[model samples]
Target: MKLKLLSITLLLTLAACKSHAPDASGPGTAIDPPIRPNPRLAAATGFDFYLLNLSWSPEYCHSHPEAAECASHSTFVLHGLWPQNKDGSYPQNCGNGPGSQTGPDASRFSDIYPEPGLLEHEWRTHGTCSGLSANDFFSAARSAYQSVKIPSQLTNLSSQTSLSPEQIAALFTQATPGLSRESIAISCGHNYLTAVAICLNKSLHPIACPAVRSCRANSVRIAPPR
Candidate 1:
């Protein structure tokens, strides 16, 4: 009788253990570990150079006529200073560092980043990865903008003009004493000249752009400011 009782107790213990055992194949049974942040996303200061994008306002305004910057009839407007890798890959939207805020002082940057939305977007996307505070980043952007001299031919275009990518780059290099053909790259959209991207070092000096593809069109139209 004692042996039978002992056997029943062992069976009961085995059933209890089986019931408590975790289900290996059951859906939603396992708790996944928290996801770790990507190391590339956290690399604020790890960049090869800076690409200062200057948007040709007329070309952009052709599509986005309602943009506030278009209202000013500017020539080349500040796009954003991007952190670029030597291989042409860039890091963007690095989430706020310790105590860092994504929103910059819009009013302070209004002259350059006329659209408040763009100001916030640039700061959140490109500016955060700059490893500088919003104010300092924008300040560096302003300085970078001032460094590039716009050729008179491009500054006061009352009518449309067509120029090859090489010619456009040449004009820039001629106008800007230190700028070189290798350091600048042109971007186009819908066969229209769009933006000029100039590569600069961390110190904001002109540098050679690595692995960047320039506009391939034989010729692109430059629209007049509206």
Candidate 2:
């Protein structure tokens, strides 16, 4: 076990180092990610789990009414699909990928992530580290999200609802039979529910994440999408 853990750590360090090397492009130019024929990284390193961050659109829209996502009605939205190391350290911008990617397809991402640059940003930042291509990474994110159902109580909430972190976690756990109390976390800001992140292994199956934490608030108000 000790040797395996050490090997995982070393692999992670190497992958991280390789990714940060300045691109051959030029002194200040950003590196572009290779269009992968096969995107899934062959094996795991320090990245032992995934975090499917589902944001409550209402809470986000309530504060930033001018945000593009606020322009339309949405329920839960994809905040990010994060790769997390067992020890809690995670990778970001781990590839010599293009700084931004955009197009009609990106605009279509409004179905879930409505902000203008968010989809592009997420792909370049966190998605690159997943060892998946732009399409595959996003596909995996969508699959991870679709595999579970959002509790109806959280949807279309007309009034602010107060609940503890444990209560929020329980909703997710109950909705996804495969998920457990240990695999879910809730986060809040400005006294309102912001996001719920569920941990998964590379297979996108629920997994234990000792390092993931719940919201600090004993109770929080959740605002539905405006």
Candidate 3:
């Protein structure tokens, strides 16, 4: 009986050892990291942000200078990225995805306003393409984005500034206001909000941004103009 037990033990140990053996496959056969288009080096091929080789070029302002001036109450500032598409040489939508517009212009809601970079924690936790509700998504976007609210008074901000998208982003980093017009552009897609929210949440305050509607509902009511 003792001999039989000892044999069983040895067999078990040997099986365990074999199961734990590492693969002897060739080097570099391990799992590789997924490749993504380099955000920095990739050409701005979409209307999402990159347009005419420039970032944050608001088309409405470029087309109607007088309206822009009235809205911002100051001369528009231009930041360099790329000029709007000229001569109609580019595709109607940027090559990145569907719904991209091509032209030498942009609307007030051209880019994702309030800038990106909020909601890092939630995004890191949930990851991309999770089946979250629109309400939850909006909340998460706000929390991650760390964006400032657009004042109700700044109606013309959309067409007022000529600053490039990159320049607009820089201004946001410094807490400068009166530049961003739309606050947030939903047509750019939810990922735009997700990306910006994550970026802002990571860059700015560690604390998440509270829900906008919830705050408004609970606060004192401001009557609309008579």
Candidate 4:
């Protein structure tokens, strides 16, 4: 895993350097590469897969009832769209963060993220590493979420129930085109289903991500949105 991450990082750096053309301002002067105080902050794009995390809003509200998100009921809300490596290595804060950095036009972020703070945090932590602008990052996240056809039964769920992780995965396969049970993973907390994750390629097409953790319980209780 370390080796793979290191290789990708190096490749991205080389790619960035390759983009700089020879100095044209001076006829005979050679341009020495500027030294970056923190190389990780340099813009670079490297990722093996996209992990679309769908947080079950009801479960989140149940645990953090005081949270702003708990004020309203939504069946499913985006947790994040993460760039992941096959070896389980991922990037974060790869470029400028929220303070001095301008991120994606977040006017529409509320539609997906429910919480305003989460939108900024996700851009700083994960979106920065995507080697894409904040707008592109958030747009990609939204598009990825829309690509999946969640099972209607789960979308309008209103009551608590129990089901195995495999059962959930099977339902997703039946719902989304070209998606398989192998592509979905269910997450749980305190014996309750908390989230569902699906893997996609950089282009947002369904793909298998390695080492995805799934709920191990034989069955987990589900909390429906109010």
Candidate 5:
């Protein structure tokens, strides 16, 4: 009788242990943690900041009249988003990923890069070094472009205008709240305003770009969009 009682107690204890055992395929099961990408690896490879290049379409179209972007009569169009070092040197062709291929869809950037060739060239030459996929890199470029506020005078010029590089930089600074003279650099070719380059941090905030050479022309002509 005692032996029978002891067996019953042991069986009950075993049953209780089995019931309390952690279930691998049931509720309350502990799941494995998800893998995460490394933060440092996800960022642009060893770049100090970004240089957002904005080309004056009228100036560009004057030389390349056949370019598709000229048809839209845009004032300021995207040139390229370049990864630059603090010393002004930049990286190019860092990888041969999807950005280097011709397959990545670029229709979404028609307003920014009206020329399809320019889109592919920029991605292969500059975006490849950005440490982001083609989509993310272009998205960043688009966002950076949209953040800048073009001055009303430049955007709505009804006639040809001329201004000093310093004056142009001042106009940009006044239009963009956080932009400053030190952060803006103007480029000119043959007395025509060609492009405006703005320096920005990884987070796309305006920053000083002392290394970029600003146009030394005393006065540069601004051609109205044709």
Candidate 6:
């Protein structure tokens, strides 16, 4: 038994020595073979995520008082807004941080990305824009659903005033020019995308005006100021 153990120990030592053995090619001068493409690395490095801020067209909403009033008051309506992409970046403005109630607000209604249902409701009730394209609206809606950011200015809006949808739409119109109620609702949809690009945050995710969302991981919750 002792001899057998000795033999086994000797074999293990030999294996260890072989593993730590120096290369005949020399030390640092040894050339390494080319690295092969790894599927795992490729997958880890490859993926697609879209994010941005949606802006509202206050000018158009203002001119159309009827619609403006409706939009302002509606709780869930996405009105008079556009996507802001001032800086070019993916997951645009995912975490823009918080805003102070003081000082001039960056377009109070600037945040407020709503869902399709609320948008349609606002159109039907305030702008008489029910005839607008649902496809375009959905494109924007889905973008918001993926993530929503409410700016601090809008937080004040929610707290200070409960304007009717029409008033809300009107307020938007007041901010813009060369736009009518009929055209504003339809055009605003496109504007939303443009606005998002403008106001996008520096991060890879969309900036939550009130809160940022990390959809692939964690989600942010922005509370409207009281």
TM-score of predicted model 5? 0.78
lDDT of 1 by residue, 1-226 (tens): 0122223323322221211111112101111112322233233476878777887878766766766777788888887777888865777667664225546788887778766666665676677778777777777778778778888999988999999888999999887776788888888766788778888777676777787767788888999889
TM per model?
0.78, 0.74, 0.22, 0.75, 0.78, 0.23
Candidate 5 regions exceeding 4 Å error are 1-42, 96-103
Query: Model 2, 82: alpha-carbon shift in Å?
Result: 0.7
Worst 10 residues of 5 by lDDT: 19-28
Can you write out model 3's per-residue Cα lDDT over 25-75, one digit (the tens) per residue?
100121111222123222332212211011112222333333322244322
* Model 4 C-alpha lDDT per residue in residues 1-226, reported as the tens digit of each score: 1112233323322221111111111101111112211232223357777777877778767656665566677766777878778876776666663332877666777777655556766777678777677776777777777767667888788788888877888878777767866667777766677778887666666666576767778887888876
Q: In candidate 4, which residue ranges exceed 4 Å CA deviation?
A: 1-44, 96-100
Better of 1 and 3 by lDDT: 1
Residue pairs with backbone overlap in model 5: none
| TM-score (C-alpha, index-matched) for candidate 3 | 0.22
Model 2 segments more than 4 A misplaced: 1-46, 97-108
Residue-level error in angstroms, candidate 6, position 74: 6.2
Which residue pairs in candidate 1 have backbone atoms (N, alpha carbon, C) closer than 3 angstroms, thus clashing?
none
The true-structure Cα RMSD of candidate 6 reads 29.3
Q: All predictions: root-mean-square deviation over Cα?
A: 22.6, 13.4, 26.4, 15.9, 26.4, 29.3
Tell me which of candidates 2 and 3 scores higher on TM-score: 2
What is candidate 2's lDDT per residue for 75-185, written digit by digit as tens? 777777788777767787665432224322565455656544566556756776776666666666766777767887777577778988888888877666667777777
Where does candidate 6 stray beyond 4 Å?
1-53, 72-140, 143-146, 158-226
Q: Could you give candidate 6's per-residue lDDT for residues 106-171 as a string of tens digits?
A: 232234332232333222321122111333323333333223323334534442233332333344
Better of 1 and 4 by TM-score: 1
**In candidate 5, what are the lDDT values of residues 1-226, reduced to their tens digit?**
0112223323322221111111112101111112222233235556888888887878766656666777888898888778888875777666665445643367887877766656766676678878777867777788778878889999998889999988989888887777878788887767788778888777676788847777777888999998
The C-alpha lDDT values of all candidates are: 0.69, 0.62, 0.22, 0.64, 0.69, 0.25
**Model 6: lowest-lDDT 10 consecutive positions:** 19-28
